[model samples]
Structures are given as C-alpha cells and as structure tokens.
Target: MAIRDDYIKWVILITILYRVGTTNSVCELSVSHGDKLYNFSLASPTWKYPHGVLSEDGFYKIARNGTVLWFQLCDGLIFNHDPPRCFDCQDCGGPSHCGMGCSALVANPLGGYYVCTTIGRSSSTKVNLIDEKNPSMGVVVKISSSGVLTNCSLSVSVFCDSNGLQGPNLLETVGTCDYATVLRHPSGCAKTVSLHGNGLGWFSTLLIIVLCFFVAYLLAGTAYRYFSLGIRGVHAIPHLEVWLSLPHRIQGLFRSLIRRFRRPTQGHRSTYSPVNF
Candidate 1:
C-alpha cells in the first residue's frame, strides 16, 4: 500500500525584535548558550515547553516530548530573535528585522541583567559555513555590536536542547561591556522546547463529526419511512396506548373492528313451523 502522509500538527515560528536570547524567564538563563549538528533551542524558560528551531538543514519543530518533527529547509532563520539596529543594517529593510545578517544577542557576559552589545551579525552564507567548521562546533558570525556590545575573549556560556543549560561558546570583553543595564533575555544560549498538541481543537472537530453521523442516520431513517409508507399507512399504526398499556391499542382496535363487521344471525330456518305441525 502507498504510504499515507502522516500529519502531526503543531504551532511554531515567530519573527523577533531581538535574538534568541530575548526572553523573560528564569531557567533559560543560560549558565551562558549548539550545533552545526543543527541543534535548535530557545531561551531557558522555554525549555519546559515546545519550541521551534531553524537551521540550514530545515525547520524542525520539537514536540513537548522533545520529538523532532521535520520541516522544510530553505534560506534564512525562521525565527530571528535578533533584530538589526535600524541604521546599522546593511540589506536592512522590512525583511531584515533580525538584522541584515545573522545576529547573535548574548546575555550579559560581564554578569547582571543587561542586554549584551556583544550582539553582532555576519553574512548568512558565511555564518552557515562557520556553523559547520568552527572548533566550538557552532557558527562564527561577525561582531557588529559597534561597541554597544563588548568584544569578549572568554568562552561564552551556551545552552542546548537535548542537553540542559550548558556553556560551550566563549565571550571576552577585553574588559568592556555595554554599560546600559536593563532586564533582558539571558543569553549565550539556544534551546529545544516541546510543542504540545492542540487537544481542545482536535477534540472539538471529532465531536462535531460524531454528531453529524448521528443526524445523518436519523434523516435517512425518516426518509425511508416516508417513501415506503404514505400518510394513510401511518394512520394504520397503533396509538400511544400500545406502547404503554396493559392491553395494547393494536389488540383493542382489531377486536373492535371484528365486532363491528359481525352480527348475530340464524344459520337456518326451523324445519317445521307451528302451522305445519
């Protein structure tokens, strides 16, 4: 038999005003932030939930159970958590929200809650190549923080999906960091989130289907009765009493009809009349 296309539905993908580090949660606080191996991830808080991953290989949606559901492979990141600096963007336009290139938004490498300026971008092609061949087994993009981000030389912290929070990449400020401090998504990370099923919607569709079948059966039965037995035939049916009575209405009706058609009569005249005797 030809294999039917198996469908597993899930919701994934979102464009960003920031990097994958852009988030508001505690756990995903990367002990930094994996893989030309094409690993996918989101910020820490998302680890307990389902999430999406974009790679040169393809877009894969991880189930809440961490099952890798296949998606299509094409150019570019599906969810660019990294938004480009408005003016600093090169091919920047409506399509360049994550910046004109692949940008990395690292968490405060210097420590404390501050959006990292270590964030930068490089050509997509180059970045993909870096992701493939880098010693860290991750991509290496250009540093375009323009000093908003510190140029780090230390191993930056990173996270993974299959694995929990960990540090693989490095960040060295050369002793500088973005002085601006604000509550920002912790970074030097990637994540895999489990996407849950649309239980409610799926059940609702199933319920509707079952109800439809029941209604169809009722209609079919009614139609058959109408075509086979006309209105007069319906009148010949037993009354409600037949359904709920000691003596059925059908039995009484038959008895009454028989009595109405039959009358008492002499079978034969007497052989001798009184006059003849």
Candidate 2:
C-alpha cells in the first residue's frame, strides 16, 4: 500500500512539472520590454542571405579593408572553404571550420589567412537574448560577447514589417570589432498576447491540474482494487458508488445553498384590524 501511494505521488509530481515546463517553454520564444512583448518564434529559424558575392554559397558576407566577415541570423555560420586553426573557438567551432553566428577571415601581414569567430552560439530560443536596451528601436537581440578578441559583440536591430523579409543588412561596423545589423522581419512586431496577458487563465490552469490529479487517482485506485482486492470489471473502480452518485450530490448541495440564501416570506397584515377592537 505504501509503495502504491509513493508511485501515485511520483506520477502526480511528474505530471505537474511537465505541464509547468510546457507553459514556460512558450514564454521562452518571446521577449518583454517595458509595456510590449516581442514574439520572435516566427523568425527563430536560421536565416541566411540568398546570394553570395565572393562565393556561390548562401550567407551574409561583407568585406572591409582586407578583412572578410561571414555571418548568419539566429544560428551559427557554416564555412564552405577550409579555415585556419582558431584557439579561442574550441567549443564553438567544428572540424569543417564552421563556428558560431559570425566568423572573420583576416589577411595576415606575413601572407597567411587567420580565421576566428566573433559571436558564439546565438539562437532565438535562448532566453534573455534581448538584453540590450534601444529606446529608439523597438526590439534588439544582441548576442553575448564571445570572440577571439576582446570587446567584440554583435547586435541585431529588429524592425516590424508585416510583409518584409528585407534584411540582415550590415548597418555599421564599429572599429573592426563590433558589428550592427538590421533585420526587417514580421517577427519583430508585437504579438496580440503580451508577456503577462491573455494566456491560460489561473482558473483554467487550476481546472486542468485538478482533472489530471483526479484521473491519476482513478487509475491508481482502480489498479489497486483489481490486483490487491481481487475485484474485476466495473467493480474495480474505487469509490464507485460515490462517483456514480456525484451528480445528484452536487445538485443537492447547490439546492441547499440556494435555500440558505433565499429571502423569507412576509405575511400580509390589514391596517383596518384595530377597528374591530
């Protein structure tokens, strides 16, 4: 009996945790700033330039002075050519020379190419990606600084354009280290549901939890009856009589409540009754 109770408790706890995790997972795809909520789930997938100038492959690329930079939105960069060893990008790079969201190939004065990655492992699903405050711009998703060099960062300013998939266009290059880009995508727009608004209400959430517990209870009770008490068929259901009469019991309870709160009847009295005396 103790073992069965423990099993039921574990099942109930797991079910509650699963439900809560599912609810929180939805919130992870969005960001809240001030009074607005920006849901970027639509643009969560990896986005790359359709055409490449230097190479036939697709990825955003730009050349400045003698340095060439390559990057992708919402994901890491994939290299089509062999890249040099980068000691700083151990966890963020692969054998194919692909690295996190952005990479740079710089020409050395001594005549060899030096390859390094700037932004490391940025994804839309990651929470707190919009930590940068840009009051003029509605939403900004900035990647955490993890570069081969010090103080290197990437900032993407997202603008609302319901019909635009316009850009990850390079806006500015800050001192050959930091890069800023603008992405005009539909996901930059505010969602109808805000961070603290119009999701499943508390009452509905409670109802779901109660229903789950009730179902679990019934299953556990039924199993116990069948296996431990040698009961079979419909008789295996625990508290079978109580459940069957629950509707009537509920109705009776409501009726009693109504009567308790009902107004009392008032008897009619004639004002002329004193004339007979």
Candidate 3:
C-alpha cells in the first residue's frame, strides 16, 4: 500500500508540472509561428526608456497634425502626470490599457484634448502576434486593440533589427490612430529551435521525467524489500509477482481476443466425400 501511494504521488506531481508547463499564458513573451520561434523575453516593462526614442521621460513620443502620441515597446508607457481623459482612460495606467504600448491624445476642434486610445495591450500578444508574411523580410511583432471610443483600432508593428536594442524606432502613423515601428533586437531574429521545440518538447521532457521517476521507484522499492522486509532472490524486486506475471497475462489477453475474433473451424471434412454432381 505504501509503494502504491508513492506511485500515485509521483504521477500527480508529473501531471501538475506538465499542465503548468504546457498551458499558454495570455501575456507570453515568446511565440512560435511557422518553423521558427520568436522570443521577446528580453523586452520587458522595466526598460528605462522606450526603444529608439531619446526622452528623459521613459516613453517614445510623436506629434503629428494636432494629435500627440506616447508609446513604449514590450512595456507600458510611463507618465509623470495623469494622462488626458479618453474613453479608454478608465482602464489606463496598466499593461492592459494605455500603458501597454501606444496612447494617443487627440485634439478636438475647440483645441482641447478629445479622446485617448490604448492601442496595444500586452495581453493581446498571444492572440494577435503573427509571423511576417514574407520570411525573408524577417519577423514582425504586431499588437493591436479595439478602440474604446472610436470605430478605429490601433496597431504597432515591431520589426527585427540586429541593433534594435537601442529601442524601437517609430516609422509612421496610419490615419489618426495606428502606428508602424521597427525593433532591431536579436529576439526578432529567427531561431533554429522553437520555444517548445528546444531539443525535446514538453511531452517528451515529461515522458523522460516519468521514466526516471519510475526507475527510481523500482530501485528504491526493491532495496526496501530486500533490506527491510528480508525478501530474497528475484522475489526481492518490488511487485515482482506483477512483473513476472505481466507477460503471461498479456499472452492470455491476446489469446482470448484471438479466440473471440477468429473464424470458427468447420467440422473435420469426411475423408471420402459423397459423390459430387
């Protein structure tokens, strides 16, 4: 009973670990697309400055027409003061809102701030991120969010650059609310191994762990039986009877199945058949 309980405990541990390791999180920094894996783990919200932007304050800023934009890459924007009020402003100040990437302060006809849009939410990375349409062009990390007040949506495209660590470079603004940008970081480059495909996948790794645990269980159980229980010879092996009988049990099962499925044999044919037509 103790050995069986040990076996159960090990199985439960493996199961929990497998589920936690394999489940995808909404804010995963690494994504696998096609044959290559892109990892943005290096890019986090803790950066002192936004990529490519030279600002004493920790965000990239852009002004076009009457609208001003503040944004960050792989992080939420930092503000010294409260941001302008907008429909999405209620959810502002966090990664799921204006902080995730892009926020816009739009000007009204009367010259007052009209609305704000939190264009990129970190939580959307898992669902919206995709590989570049052209592999040769390199990886593109696209993140977007539906507007809180307007019909428009906001998007930011992060391109791969070998030197992108300086931060992301804002390339252009689309219409009144969207953005295009480039990030030249090594993480954007293609990887030979996938996020889960590094040497072995989660399933394979778990399988190996289970096998190791099983072997350890056998060894430990056998030793206990030999020393503590005074079991002798082959009988000292833990569950020796079960192991020894497994082959014969398997054979019996196969034979039973075969008998169930096999065609019935006809009665022995008469050595001399009756005269045939």
Count of clashes, each model: 39, 0, 6
Error of 1 at 157 (Å): 7.9
lDDT for every model? 0.32, 0.54, 0.52
Please, what are the lDDT tens digits per residue for candidate 3 over residues 1-277? 9999999999999965663343223223545567665544334222433322223364666555555556543344556654443444554553334443333323222335455555665444432344545442344444456654543333444444555454444546675555655545544444345545458778999999999999999999989999999988988888888889999999999999887766443224445579978
lDDT (10s digit) by residue, model 1, range 127-169: 2222333323332222233442334221122222244323222
Cα-based RMSD of the predictions, in order?
23.3, 17.4, 20.6
lDDT of 2 by residue, 1-277 (tens): 9999999999999966774453244323455566666554433322342221112242456545545555544444556654444434454554354453343322212235455545523432232343346322335555545443455555666665667466654657665566666667655554534556667989999999999999999999999999999999998999999999999999999999887666343122433356553
> Which regions of candidate 3 fall more than 4 Å away from where they truly are?
1-57, 81-115, 125-148, 166-176, 194-277
Off-target runs (Cα >4 Å) in candidate 2 are: 1-38, 42-58, 79-96, 100-115, 123-138, 147-149, 194-277
Please report how far candidate 2 places residue 180 from its true position, in Å.
1.1
Best by lDDT: 2
In the predicted model 3, the residue pairs found to clash are 51-167, 51-168, 52-167, 76-99, 161-184, 164-184
Each prediction's TM-score versus the true structure: 0.22, 0.41, 0.41
